[model samples]
Target: MNTSLKTILTASVASLFPLGAAQASEPATSGQPDTVLIQAKKISAPNVDGTSQAAALSASSDSAALLRDVPGVSLYGAGGVSSLPAIHGLADDRLRTQVDGMNLISACANHMNPPLSYIDPSHIGSIQVLNGIGPVSNGGDSIGGTIRVNSPDPEFAMAGEMLRKGQAGAFYRSNGHAHGVNLNATHASDAWSINYAGSLSEAGNIVAASPFKVVSQGNGGKPGLAGDVIGSSAYKSENQSLQMAIRNASQLLELKLGLQNIPYQGFPNQRMDMTGNRSEQLNLRYKGDYAWGQLEARLYHEHTRHSMNFGDDKQFWYGNAPGMPMDTEGKNSGTLLRAGLPLSERDQLNLGIEYQRYRMNDWWSASGTGMMMAPGTFVNIADGQRDRFGMFVEWEANWNPNWFSQIGLRAERVSMNSGPVAGYNAMAYGNPASPLSVPGAFNAANRQRADHNLDFTAVARYTPDSSFSIDGGYAMKTRSPNLYERYTWATSNTMVMNMNNWYGDGNGYAGNLNLKPEIAHTLSATFDWHSANPDQWQFKIAPYYTDVHDYIDAVPCSAASKICPGRKDGFLNLSLSNQNARLYGMDVSASALLLSTEKYGQFLGNAVLNFLHARNKDTGSGLYNIMPLNAKLSLTQHLGHWNTTAEIQMAAAKTDISAVRREMTTPGYTLLNLRSSYTWKQWRFDAGIDNLFNRFYRNPLGGAYLGQGATMGQGVPSGIVVPGMGRSLYAGMQLKF
Candidate 1:
């Protein structure tokens, strides 16, 4: 689908939202130390302080919330700690998200744990989000853009001195009885540094403003969920990490070890909950500065062991089947080598080489202690493997002070293969097509596939003066289908398809073997108007349009995939397909210093408005899970060591929906959030209230409500949208020692 310039201009009234701007910078070849900011492009975090108190004090435990203020970014509602971030209407595997320089893949079928979930906010030193026009050397195999979250660097003491520092913080939120604690400690000398960071967070079911749906009664005398409560919304997660750094005058060596344990996490939209998930990671990196260029090399390995079953909110007994349990195991390892070479005084070149290998296994165990789901083990995915090799070269030129340009090209080769799979039994499971037979067909079909993708980006930044600037560019990006999008078999089995859904839309999805890589062409520009001084006043607007080919969507499945037909207002069973899509949007953001006086205090105001339109050109239907028109406005006051902010958030009613997915619509609503913080030397305290009025509203990206009941076989009714939080009070305190 090629969206014309006329079409984009036609939708200008309600189309675009711009947040902020990024300045293209020439890469440093020499005269500087090698840092994580060695790429051809430079992108800053949301604020001066990365993962600031505002994020830690918020009621939500999801660290992805830190990107809420960034332009062209939104989140898909998931578990308490795992929210999938969407960039310019593209999400999940479509975005390249890196954590501590490692490209992590979601191991679970439901995608309950995304990359951001691995690192707690307290451990973050910086977060940067780049839209589609980012330089090719930033990353590859992605269309939406790139997100980088780097851990804090080692802080060494002065010459001949020792460094010792530690900080502890804790917070509590009322809505879901959510609470958490975080600790950070560092010990370093002038030459070496050792640091450890840890956090623990837990929450119960969240309470809605009002009763929204009637849940089913569980089997074996288990009562149904309460009306005012959103079930399967609870979670508990613990993370610990250790870092050691060794540095010389021109080189730095770092080693990081990370461990995560998510004992349990409930998903209100998915049929199953995460009962247990554990992951371990080891990362090694070295950065050096040479006469001609700066080079950085990193190698990392991660492994995940995950398990899922019915949580307390859902029914456990199903006649002979006591509980359905699913397990997934995955291993990921990758290497990244990047270098910046100076070509001349005004030009720099960045070259990158990358390799990644991932292996995964998904299987289901018989239920009821091997009585109910008899036959044998159901092998959903056996020995799945995906490997990627990529290379890119980018050039950034500083054309005087008034104009700058960046151009780059990238190429990637991705290969995937999966072993044979089998169902629980060889007999037909009451399906017209005989669900058990599909496994044989799937196993016999060609399971190995590969794709070659090429990407290009051209960006230009113009600043006529200090008060005004414009940044615009064109980007062509490509991404291959993920494992879940290409390897999920068994189209005839509704039970199996239902378990593969990651959108939480209450629909069953079966993967298709014949899928193509998605290619996207994007045109975007950001215009800025502001005062010359720092923090006085600034306004930015960005408008963007993207045309995507071979977009992964869905189509009606064979009749055999039906889930107990004749149900009223039910969900659909569909198979994945490649389609065409077009997305256009704009973002507007402004900040101004309202007042400043020594006798009083300083007051600042900030506001942002976003609008997006995405449609499947092949089907002429709106895309799924895209956020609607929304605005965020805030006023902040600073007096002495105290800071406070009052924020108002508004979202227009989401009426445009994906019919193929039976997407739900949400009503427009407004929310008020208030927070205040006080700092006293080594002590800091924060307090906030979210949804101050106890307003009732639905989450635009919440998908459907499958939080409770017999979700396995369409036992739960549809049409109920997930509700947003209401009237949550929170307080946090931190102390340094």
Candidate 2:
């Protein structure tokens, strides 16, 4: 589905219909889940101006990019399809993201495949983001907040009629010669329906406005790096899914099968690239209405086989072997049950239970026969397992016509364990003079661990009138460390440590087995004011603060550890440690009706500003990768079937960086974008020019440039920030019948 910030900021609160509230919606269900109600919905069409920007939004494959304009939301540059979203000041595993009610986890050490990359943007029906104080039922195990993405639901036909509909669309961008195509078809009777969605996307290395740094070149692609191109930024992906559903009045059952294959995908921030990734999913769901309320149950299984190797720009040979091949396999199965209970006109209760089982095995065979390449296989994570079981209860009440409240509590148990591991040359690798190999220490340590976590939240809303309302809440959340954070054992060899870096900073990391779970306490509030008629004007501001105990920050490797020694100054070896952290942020947004006339057209304006501050309270140091002050301004014009928008996006220079990591800072810059759409009959077309002025600036959060050269052990050049994309014109068309 296509979405824009204009729709989200101006959406009405009536759409907050509880999942099991009063009625049943077949294809278009309620946006808010029973236990989650932050009231931010991604509407498909642009209703703010009575027009749509489907053409411009669907031209890219990255689903995470859709949140670019969202308040307090930032993107971490990765593969073409694998960008990670950072809410507030936290990113990665800190956020609870679900796809079609399934909690999927990244199985790679480098997190090359994030949950958002599993589904294509063209197939997304709606996206809901609770970028604030979310209730416990929204989920446990995360602190950044929650995001739910769903695909279009099956549509049934009239009483005695048959239904058949299909849509096809394609898009292309001038930069990197990016292009893709999508197809979806639906067939249904009164009570039965079948739907299919498939898409293919690919792109070459993207170029910057100009060369950011000078580096060695070998692939003979372009000047500087490759036409000022970011090496290893190419990607190719295909996805297909089939869903079958049957419904009898208020009851519905569905079965969905999904398949995904990525032949090759490059990353400008990381050293290794995704050579192959194959994934399959089977999901079954049941939902029905009973006398008590609504009941829902789901069971799913997902498997992935992933491989990493040198891409087009990175070096391929390592002394003897043509390439260093790393392989990983992961299996995940989960079950969820939820029940919505109605006690009275003003009271509602939501109860849920969830259980998940995950198994993973990561290993790299001996290769190259070099100093770092031993003769034995290197087992990164052998037979690793993490199981989670949780239950939650949430209560909602409308005390009167003007006040509403919700409270939730969740409890869960997480059990993690892993088998023994061995490094290359299991015996010879251990340095007797200094200390035993980390493998020995890791194998001998007690890897089995269990954590009983609890989460609690309380929120209240007061609306004295239709023009103004205020919402405030406090949340206490808990999150256990991911498998990679506690089980990665290699630390002696820089190459091995390099393989474990997921932050894309050209640094090395090792996991700390004794790390504790992170606990966060957040306080948030939102004040909204709008004209009697929402379309006429609106304004809102939200501010939030969070304090975390045992935050997972990294510390320089100490000689006392005796495993990893000889740390380099620029590119140091580090270990994950627990530290206290605090973060605060605020979002201010305003929208207004600029002008409307029969002779001309309708004009609307919207703007948003965001500011963030984060610090490691324990060490009095700046946190890493925190987004800087940023803002967006847009003016949209609408006339009959034609719509156009001009946008300006800007960010402040980044100076508050992690001193320990020797993080590099970036200079701020601004760019303009122009987009337009036109619709006729059953067809719609969209076109846009990004970086209209061809601005040259670096992405503050893009991390170091490690896309090319010999990246095995500091041979690749560092201290270069990844450059932003240059000017590019893109266009797309869609038809429905």
lDDT of each: 0.81, 0.79
lDDT of 1 at 145: 84
Using Cα atoms with residue i matched to residue i, what is each candidate's TM-score against the true structure? 0.92, 0.92
Give the per-residue lDDT digits (tens) of candidate 2, residues 121-158.
77777666765477787768988887777777778999
Worst 10 residues of 1 by lDDT: 24-33
Candidate 2 — worst ten consecutive residues by lDDT sum? 17-26
Residue 17 of model 2 has an lDDT of 15
Q: Can you list the residue pairs that collide in candidate 2?
A: 1-124, 222-227
Distance from true position, residue 240, model 2, in Å?
Answer: 0.5
Report the Cα RMSD per candidate: 5.8, 6.3
